[model samples]
Target chain A: MPKQAPVPDELSKPFWDACNERRLVVQNCTACNRMQYPPEQTCSECGSEHNLEWREVSGRGKVNGYCVMHDSRIRLLQADQPFNIVVIELEEDPAIKFLSHLPGTPVDQVPVGASVLVDFQEVGPGQLIHEWRVVG
Target chain B: MAPTGWFPTTRNRSQEGLGVWEHRGKVAVVGIGNSPTARRWDETADTSVGAWAISAAQKALDEAGISRDEVDGVVTCPQGMGSPWAPNPIPEDFAKAYEPTDNPDDGLTGVSADWIVKNMGLKNVKATYHTPACISPALCAGAQVVGDGEASTVLVIRGTGNFSGRYGQYGAAAGDTASGPGQWTNPWGWQLIPQIAYGFDQYCRKYGSSHDRMAPFVLNQRKNGALFPEGYYYQHRPDDLKISVEEYLSARWICKPMNIYDCDMPIHTAGAFLLTTAERAVNMKQKPVYVLNHVSQRAKVRSSVETLDETEAFTDSIARKVYEGSGLTASELDICNPYDGFTLFTQYFLEGLQWHGVQRGEAHDFYAGDISVKGPHPFSSSGGNNGNGRTRWWNQLDCIQQLRGTAGERQVTLKAETALAGAFTPNMSDWMVYGTSPD
Candidate 1:
């Protein structure tokens, strides 16, 4: 099976569109001035419905945590077996973290709290996914 | 500690009434039943969704000495009945029989209250199905129905042939066919195993815990599994009972920070609990376990925010609410059946419930003999999901058995006068405390 692609809904379209352009974006609440991932219709912090905006974020952040997958439930993920999945806490807002794969980083080198940069890859015809790689 | 009194408050079943501790304990679990875990190859012509459900329900009813005609209320979880890959012998998936007319989702996406009434061949009954929460929701719903005078006898049933039926595995097919949030996780290689592993990895980072620290919890579960004759690992893989730290670490890692032992063994099984008013249960054949409290809560936020908030997932507030409602402290609980979907959950729950004031960073004696059936504080003596069968809400069944003093060799030494059962899944959490006798 091909890699699992997220079925972007109306609320998440802009976030995916930005990812398609190799730019990382998240929903920034105007009221609370906080960033949210996995875009939702309403601002989770302030409950502001009308002022939510998609803001591009500098995807440089410290690794909140990570896991090295030696086996995957999905066969596609196992194609590149023994991969690393990292949760990156974006610098724009430390609370706003994104879940992504650490494509090229070795298991031991994928350190928790290490600075990382988001890198984009085209996994399908029109689908693009963001990955994280450790940076000095 | 002995079980608390029943219905400490006056007759009021409204939102305000919920605050009153007396509103609870009016309902009791009168009967319990379980079906053997099956494998993919164990399918027969009769193992349809309806057949499996009927088998457990019949057993529970027989234990209660209540006939089909006596049941006035029914609650069910059909989450497992839909897998097209499983050989469900029923003519069609149960969802198709009564898909909500309003909802757009089709196929086995939903199960209506009418479906259970029809399939179980029961007469006029107040039936509600498809309100799927983790197994605890059905228990809470069943208890409330009897307590509120909606029904004299309520039957709560949960059956999942998912493991044997759905591609002979715990998870569904990946990629394009993936359903729910699972599809979203796949592209990032965030399958269920790793996603959960990350939860523990984050916890370890915050609390400074290690594989060695968590190892004993898994070992304790395996030890309990050996005592549980029904556990698949106990019966088939007897060697699992003797797992060592070296064997656990050397085992091929499914995900970093988590080995094969950390994951729950998915098996095909079904469990049912029969609930009725304390008055009705007085005449029942078996001992009635009083339902002290059934409280559920959801996090204020959803998605990544909640997922990343390691503390929120196992918030102390969840346990505080249960303790406040049940009027029972951690010490008062003779037995606690915390959700063990993952072995790591044991720590999350122990800390969340403030069991012995155990904090996130405090050292826990998971290796103490008290963690076993004969110990003072036995955890999921039925081996939990770790070693026992992974039937949703199976912990509740174990709690009932413990309180009824029918757990056989695995029964807790406290006489199980007061027991706590908690379930945490995704964004939702629920807890219920049971007692041996009414106040």
Candidate 2:
């Protein structure tokens, strides 16, 4: 089964567009100079709706926190049993981390503060999502 | 002076007490009631969401000594799942017994405020419905309507039957232009458990907290739940009550750094609270629990904002306003009940309330003290949402009970004194302080 895909709208179209191109982009509030995630209509930091822009990010972050799903009631997720769902804190902004499944990593070896790089995988037709891999 | 109809910005001493805050002593919780909480597998026709709410409302009204005719305002905090007619697609099995009436379009969703009012035969009542049920907001709404002279009595009702269906049945993270599970989190395989596990993970990294340090707080809740006769775990699953660190550690992990016991028990339950003017409360049948302060507001980041470090200083605003508005300190509170849907929230809110002195980005021994029913500061004397059934507004119920000096075996030492209870949703935090009388 294909991986879970997000339903994107106009406010989030740009971020998802960047993902299809294998680029990590986030919403930058021109007013507050604060970067945010999961794209929004306005800057959550400054409430600026007019000056929002989609900007590419380094896509490198440290492990903020994570969990290992030993079992899932959802059938589609069961194929990737015992996977690690990591919340990565982007290097550009500690507060702007995103959620992604970290495949092929030993659960015990998962580092809480280790650096990681973002990569994309096709979840469905013409659909690409950002994922994380540990970096030395 | 407190605002007669609306609260002013500055603090003022009023007839109620210091810093009456607009609603202080203006609205009183004259009655509290709960339907027996049971597992979904144990659900009966009587336990349907509507039935549970009606039963609870009847009891609360009975306790208040107010007839249905007296209720002019009804505030409904419906479950997260959609109404029976157009039910949520995810929890497909839930409310299957609910058959759409001949007039499904009449807007009488069984859980809606209008339906509740009609069912109770309340006359000339203004009904307000709060979508995506979270009980705290309803309590705050009820207090506002009555305190502002909009109505004399308001009935706040909330119930959840998710246990019979499933969690995440309604999806996570709400947004506009996008319906059904919002972006980032769901697409990335993140749900409630993983999301919270991440927050606690960050807490551990910054503060140096480990499993050992966090277990005591959860254990304190278990102990408190054990003391309550009606607690689901203690009563039905008696053997599960005496959980230890060893047992907790050995349990299978649903999410990293969190075990099975770290989460809340999912059970179907309904609760009702009756709000009336303080003067009227004095004439009621039950002990009056005055609404000293009701503060509900957002923190720095909206809950919808998907971020890695969401927990950092998120509850700061809630803490600041609750302390300042209520004119009470952590030490002054005889009982404290924070949202404990997840044990992590209990710890975070405890620290936010200054019950513990843990600094940000640093960890301390969370289990160092006895934070039990007999502890220095009694927290969740009714076992909270963790040990108790997730009755949605159990915090308020427990707070009212403590302040009324009727908590029975789980009674707090400072009964009939100041008690603080908090409610937390994804992006917002609200707190309510209750006192036995006008201070």
Candidate 3:
């Protein structure tokens, strides 16, 4: 329920911006040609501090794994029933370590290798985060 | 905000087997002590969990034939994240913080195994902290302390309430999206546990196992729980330990198969292991217990974290590494206190070592019987996590009493050549196989 952007630092600002714009953006290091999310200034792979830019991915990925959570706060946000969260692998993206919320209609039905795209929800104003739902 | 996935990785397990002890280390465990396990201590009491820990520590020191002042290093595990609904949050023992100050010579701190090495301020005095659902890893920390040599003698402490009650209850709101008493709520990352479970369930399904069959495994675990006096659920031995798609938890199932009993209880008790190296143990006035061996494993891949990796299995996950370190195999073990936070956890090991070639199929008739000294493989004389309390105290105490031959009526006649202990499920367990020669 944070009113202001909880985005604290310069390095992580892009992720928050993408959330506000409803467009999921990732950082791609031009030097190593690698794509990363949770936008780090430096590349974890090859450790190059080279040209990094905000690049928009297809916003689609495969469910590498998924989890069902029953959080007290989650109840306040949505239904008191089971909801799915997942780790997804972006298609043909470099620095491919992608982890985020999987927002399918039902958690039980989230399948491995299930094709998914990012879906955003507004819990608080000026704040929208991406959740994934199964597509094609 | 969900904490960023980046966590400080555990101290490298890769450095093990390559440490100095790989050659010259000759450490033998000398003493161990634990508080009696009980259900629900009144937090509003004069006797605090801190007091319980000190009492156990005193008994451990007494058993080790060492003086508290003689200790030069210490090891401690952080108290469990106590209940959010509890009146007093984080029932910390200022006493634990004070133990180092009280003793002065042997104080230690840091996260898991790293503490022993850093604070005991010795090149060799090893120390570490752990949270492996229960006490087995804490016990393993005690062994690592002795083996790594942060202090000539190391004291390992595990405890929580009676002195502090509210801190010992599990948050009911977890898994349950509702605000009901039976609903699930986790202020902590506990909700992540369900996700982990789902990940594991997916693994099981991929392997063609169904939830109906998994229920029997869980029910068998509940039965084992029926034997313990202090276990969270002491009376009911559910006839079936099965996993279901319907999700039988307070909240939408926190992952399939893992139920309330399958989880370690929020506890108000203390357990400690006081260890002295063989050389120092001899000089001390106390007759010391010996540690035969210790083993540990970190995940090789970003493997499933919520449940046992169905493919690699818990036993194959680290048992052989520990078996080699402890110099034991299924054949040589006399007692086993495998980390049984959940049922199939021990069975996972049972399946891997093929405890008598036990296999993993949908309907493998798996029931744990007391393998006595008189019988083939005398295992978990205290009912593993099931029969014994899941609190880590049993893990250490089981090995201690076995080595000391003080298991009372439950004592096995044959002197145990090896007693294996671990915290193998859902985390990197510090597993060790202890040996005994009652001379």
Candidate 4:
């Protein structure tokens, strides 16, 4: 297997910087004013060669959907556990979408379209990254 | 809500096959099939979901027709549960689970193969695509259609490895972020929370409760699911599904109005089906299940999920559309599958059919044994995703088995019947109904 390739260059640099700081950032194109993941160099909404800036979000959102993914590689890479995949419909000027796991909560107990706020979980030194979690 | 007819006999009956058959005017899902359930090691990482799905496509094709090249276009969706929790969330009852060595990919490979066949522009070629978590792969197989974008022949099949505790799932981040799988999954950021719990959290909040209350609902779901071998909670019960407010802190925050139990389970697998237009089916091998009527539509607003104005999250527009298209009322069916992953969904599904004047209340009046192909109405006798099995493993497999009359211990004695199956979600909802025989 090709060594699980690193997050490509076009999508790198900034992504690394945010994770090291425990801040969650999404790349929004100024030209198209659309948010993208996998760090698109070209705007997906409009064919514009736009530059992306790491803008922070309120991290407040609702659970549009969810599931107990009985299988995964990412979490297994860290801990041998079955993590939940929570699909977040963000609440921003133009809401963004995200998928991630929760911290310290039993996802099965959660419901659809629930309100939540952002939180962080430390994984490593300067390696702390933002993870979604249910807020009270 | 009285049944229009106790039983009607369809004039179409073909006795070409060797196996014992029944003709009761109602259409029965006479055929059931699958692709080989791949072990973790049998397939490769690059093995496309289409590859896994096509295996079963061939089997369903063999059942539908002898020619392998008669298929058409393809349609399918990934219907397995959407993981919405921690980096790695195990089955509620992980202690009693078996793990697979490998996992399967998502999408309609089964339908893709059908496209390979149908796009050949074969006459009588048609395609359909469907998936509701466990039965996703199977739905892919059913969507085969040829030229003109519409063929008389269509096939639907889905397969699932079913979650057997073989693998764990994690969503590092569906957002544009710098988080690695590990760093992304860590509870370091809130922006990346899975949306599942948020749905429930929102629901509870709006209802003036906490997400913790959803446990009883799920526990009950597990209780009902115990009857099926393929159920994710085969060994779990309501008592074990406990979660406190503090203990339930998992996701960063996804969606609202629903929660974890409110969501579906993500598993591996495939299923397939061979569908022929009623006209073409009449000329084919044996008496095929006829599509007397169907109504499929998606609510842009998820009328079902609305807080209260609607009787249910599911609305009646589509079910009514089906009734009008089929020129039949809910009083016309002998069986039903309400796309039940949870009771709430099922309740709304029932209401949708009821809007078409289906006396769902009366259907439950008959005894389980009395409610058969020969008796009143049998709803999900092979067990629904919630009743017998779920998407992770047995959703498609069980539906096929029941419709085909191949369900081992839970088989109902019905010669003629019409069955309904559906998949409902916030984004899209699909509803389909087929008659085993046209009386």
Candidate 5:
């Protein structure tokens, strides 16, 4: 079976669309001038729904933490067992974190606190999802 | 302290005043009942979730010497039918046939308060509550109801069912499109284990802790579980209970920094507690374990999983509130039963509470010492869910039993007058302080 693709909803469609274009965008509150991710209807910082706008980010982050998956509950990814799942703390806003497999990174080699750059992978046709890669 | 009748507000970090715990010393846990833990649905035994729940509740009521007619309130978690990720629905025919009577209890997927009242022929039930939270919160709610004079006696129960399959397997049947939060994680095959593994990873990096330091805690819990007759390991896998440090160290990694032993086993089980006013508990059969205070908090997670800092703050808030509300200090706790659903949670709870002066980021070091039932501070003597099964009841039950002097072989050698028990995770969790005396 193929890897699962992200099913975009009304709230997340713009984010996925931006990913398809190889851009990383987060919700920025005009009132508070803070960023939020996994796009919410209302700005998480200032709670201003109308004041929220999508802004492209540097796609640069640091490894907050990571794990090596020796076992997977999702059967589709079992063949890729012992993979690395890295938590990327966005440089734009450390609070806005993302989980990425850091594809091509060897298992148990996730460098905590190391810088990373966002990259997109197509899990399904026309469906690209954002991931991260460690920067030298 | 008289009944102030004033609701205690959240105290500032100063932790000075004895906040009015409205239910403190008012509600008493008089009896506890647990069903035999099973690995999965036993076709041979032919038990239903409803049957287990009712049986556990009945055992509790019997121990309390309280008739079904006397129960005035029922509080329960109604969604323990199967794994939340992937549930095995009860067959329509079996469900219908199982309960042929009018207002029949579902007894398969879940059991509601009304169904329990009806199924048990409870006569005087005046209040009913169904909470999706864990067992600790359910009991806390029941105690609050009784303390508020809505009901004099209440029954708090939880039943968990397991179907035969690998736990938490998001089968291909779940489809190829990850929705909502999964859209971000599932596409990368990042699931619950890895989510927690991230937290542990952060803990190890920040605090200089390692899984090797966690071996003694795991081995201790397994030893305790082996001795606990009511637990799953004691009942089913007696020979496997003798876990060693070598075995624990060599345990296959479910996720890095977390061995298979770090996770609690999901099982088929039910547990119930009977609570009444302290006034009524005096006339009951067992010694009353006073409900000193309880704290429930929402997780402060701005992302998919809570950061180590967020979890620490969350648990610290709970600990401060519990101590202030109960008018007790962490030093006064005779036993500690932090939730060991995941072994890391135990560390979070202990360090969060600062029990016995265990400083921040020092729980791993604290576990390096003697933490057995005979230790200075008996930690998770009931073996918790890690040693037992994922019933989420052992910690509280052990608290009651320890305070009541009925823990048998698992009893702490110390005074064991007061204990702290909690459930779920450090981020989103509930905790209660139990005492031998009301004051």
Candidate 6:
């Protein structure tokens, strides 16, 4: 079986679309001037509906924390066992976070608080998911 | 003084004092019951999820010495079959495909109050509620029902059923696409373990704690769980379930910072508690464990998983609420049974409550000390979910038992006048305090 890919709904489509184009975007609340992620219909800060605007970001972040999975419950990812799932706090908004396997980083060696940059991976046809890479 | 306008301002009787919980000592838990914990749903004729719920309810009623006809209220946290993360099957589709029998108790994965009422033949049930969380909140709701006179005797139950498959396996998708939050998490193989492990890792790094300091807690839970007759290990393989410090330290990692022992064993089980007004409870068969106060808080997290700081904030808020509501201090607690569904939660609760002067980041050091039932600060002697199977109610059950002097071999050596219990994570959780007297 192929690895699971993001099947974006209407609200998340733009965010995923930006990823496909090798860009990272976050939802900027026009009303509150606050940033959000994973797409919401309303501004979380101001609760203003239809006031969310997509804004492209530098895609830079820092490793907040991480865990190395020695086992895989997902069958397709079993072959790629012993991977790291790193929590990335986006440079755009520390509150807006993302999970990444941190592909190139060595297992059990995630440097917490180290800087990282977003990288996209095509797991399925036209499905570009965002991952992170350690920045020197 | 009377108000001049239509809005009278004579402090509503219940809200007389700001932040004062009027429901303190208004309700009491008289009895607790548990079905035999099992690794899987034993395919026995009388061992369905609904059946287990009914059995637990019956035991509670019996233990309370309250007749079935006296049960006037029911509250349940229903459990569905299959992976908990799987999308719930449409009710109509599920009923048509799976629920064939008209008997409410038969062929049930999730057990509801209506089914329990029908199965137990509870004729006087006037109030029914479903708390989508776990048994802690169900008990809280039950207490409210009794305290508010919605019912004189209320039974709160939580039942879990496991199907034949890997626990928490992702539901088979229609295609290779992951929708919803799974789109972000599942794609990277991020499941519950990694999510929690991340929190533990952050906690260790921030606090200078290490996994080695956690062995005492793990071993303590196993020791107590081995003695708990209703637990899965004790019921199934009592002889082989014991663990040593070396064994826990050497245990293989499911995820770094979270070995297999750090996680609670999921099992098919159901637990029920009988609650009533403190007035009525004083005359019941068992000694009344007064419901002093409870706080249910939902933390605001910016991300899918709560950060360590967020968890600490959540814990601190809960601790303050619990103390303010009950008018009790952490020093006054005789025993504590914090949720250990994930062992790390226990550390969070200890540090959060500062129980017995355990300061921030000092829980690991506290754990390194004596945490046995006979220790100054007794913790989770009932084996919790870590020692017991994941019944999710053992903490509360043990609290009630400890307060009532009925915990048998696992009872604390101290004069157990007061106890505390909680469920789920430090963030978004339910916590309650129980005492031997209403005061």
| Highest-scoring model, lDDT | 5
Tens-place lDDT digits, model 4, residues B1-439:
1111111112111111212112122222333444433222123422323444555566666666545455543444433343322233323322122221112123322223233233223344334344333343233223212112354344454434333342333334322233343322333222212222334333444445554443433343343355444443443332333434343345222233333444444434455556555445566655566544433343332111222223233345545654554445677654556665543344445555772233333222222123322234444443445433334324334445555555555555653255556554422444445555554
Best by DockQ: 5
Fnat, model by model in order, equals: 0.60, 0.38, 0.12, 0.06, 0.74, 0.69
Cα miss at B160, model 5 (Å)?
0.6
Candidate 1 chain B weakest ten by summed lDDT: B1-10
TM-score versus the correct structure, for each prediction: 0.87, 0.86, 0.70, 0.49, 0.93, 0.91
Q: Of the true contacts between chains A and B, what fraction does model 3 have?
A: 0.12
TM match of model 2 to true structure: 0.86
- Please give the interface root mean square deviation for model 5, in Å: 1.7
> What DockQ would candidate 6 receive versus the native complex?
0.58
lDDT score of residue B20 within candidate 1: 37
Task: Considering only chain B, report the TM-score of each candidate against the true chain B.
Answer: 0.83, 0.83, 0.67, 0.56, 0.91, 0.89
lDDT string for model 2 (A20-122, tens) is 9999988887878888776677787778799888888888988766777664544456567667777677898887767667665676567878889998887
Q: TM-score order of candidates, best first?
A: 5, 6, 1, 2, 3, 4
Candidate 6 segments exceeding 4 Å error: B1-18, B81-107, B172-175
Residue B147 error, candidate 3, Å: 4.2
Interface RMSD, all models, one decimal each? 2.7, 5.3, 9.5, 10.1, 1.7, 2.2
Give the alpha carbon lDDT tens digit for every residue of A16-66 in model 1: 678899999888888888777767778888888988998888879888877
Worst 10 residues of 5 chain B by lDDT: B1-10
For residues B250-340, could you state the per-residue lDDT of candidate 2 as single tens digits?
A: 8777676667777776666677899999989899999899888877655455333334344545555466667776777766667778888
User: DockQ, per-model, please?
Assistant: 0.54, 0.39, 0.19, 0.07, 0.69, 0.58
